[model samples]
Target: MSTKTVLITGTSSGIGLATAVAAAQSGWQVIATMRDTAKAGALLAAAEAAGVTVDVRTLDVTDPASVEACLAGLDRLDALVNNAGAGHLGTLERESVEDVRTVMEVNFFGVLHVTKAAMPLLRASKGRVLTVTSVGGVIGQPFNEAYCAAKFAVEGFMESLAPVAATAGVSVSVVEPGAVASEFVSNVGLADNALEQAGPYAPALSAYLDRTRGAFAHAQTPQDVAAQMVELLAAERPAFRVLTSDAARAFAGAKLKDLDGSAVQTLTGTWVA
Candidate 1:
């Protein structure tokens, strides 16, 4: 049997890097992509350390041309992992419209760009489309309004397309992860100054940050999330949604089980006042 090939975006670090390495070690021909090839040294070193090979390619998911050019070179693609995403942290009042649009561009529209570019190849190969959403996608979190909105949009988009994609022999799945130990915090532009700049929202921002810090204290590792991605890709019939850890499932389950918005409000309200 021939080895399967998988293309994953944002492989410069974190879950994308871990997934790329793990998939290669598991016998898949991995195409690990990132917006900037210069940052690929870490992924390359990790792959070498694991005694596996990954073809690191430059791909900015926010750019349709880049997505097309990157995938155009690939001869085989059995799986498309839309792991590229941006993070945003700030209340709507503090967040600029431009910042919100940036998040939407990368986290929401970026997925569409890559998925649309890969659909033809995926349909021909009977491949899978797996995306890394977040627990915030299931239930909106304080200070993550814009980010969560983008994730929620992606979740809805994928869920709606899953059945239609299935008819073409494509499988669609989403992996929702809670706080995973990664560079995501910094990537999302969250910094110490965020609280200082909250203005009238300072006290609430501080409380929310405290709660967020507590949650990340027991956060899952990138490998933990990557493991779930591997399983989703390998499963004969993967589920539409797979939460990375027990905490993630429990956290997201609150909203999943509660048809009314009360449960989510009660939970998120804890970080406010």
Candidate 2:
């Protein structure tokens, strides 16, 4: 039996890095990719520390040419993990349209770019596509309008494509993770000062931040989420949607169970007022 190969995007840090290492440890050949190869030292070091080897590749998911070039030499692809994403924080009214577009470009369109680019190989190998979406994709939260919108778009797109991809022998799944200890908040520009400058939204933002901090106090680790990804890739029949933790399942379940939207509104409403 030959070892399976998986190419994961955004392997410079966080979940992407963890997934790459975990997959390698699970006996898969890992092609850990990132937008900038210069930042790959951490992933390489981690892989070495884990007593595994991973091929580091440069891939910028938002750029179609880069996506193409990254996969050009790949002969076989057992899995493609679209973990590359960007974050945006602030109310829709305060966030610039450009910033919102940027988030969509990376979080939503980036997935499409990489998935589409890798689809031919995936189809050829009957591989799997696992994406790291968020609980926000299923349930919109306060002050996360733009970010949630992009995630929601990813969820919708993947769900609609899953059946069609299945006909070609490709399995697609979205992993929704709640708060995990990662650089996501920082990457989204949600530092303390940034939240403090919310102006009229400060109080609500503060409250939301407090709640988020409390959540992170017990947040799942990136490796925990990575374990789920690895399991999905190895499953004979993977589910369409997977939440990383009980909290994530419950958080996203609110929207799934409440068709009227009142439950979500009431829950998020507390953070705003």
lDDT of 1 by residue, 24-69 (tens): 9888999999999999999999999999999988999999899999
Where does candidate 2 clash, by residue pair? none
Candidate 1 clash pair list:
none
TM-score of each: 0.98, 0.97
Each model's lDDT comes to 0.92, 0.91
Steric clashes per prediction: 0, 0
Q: Which ten-residue region of model 1 has the weakest summed lDDT?
A: 186-195
Best by TM-score: 1
lDDT of 2 by residue, 92-155 (tens): 7776899788889999999999999899999999999999999989988888888899999999
- Residue 70, model 2, lDDT: 88
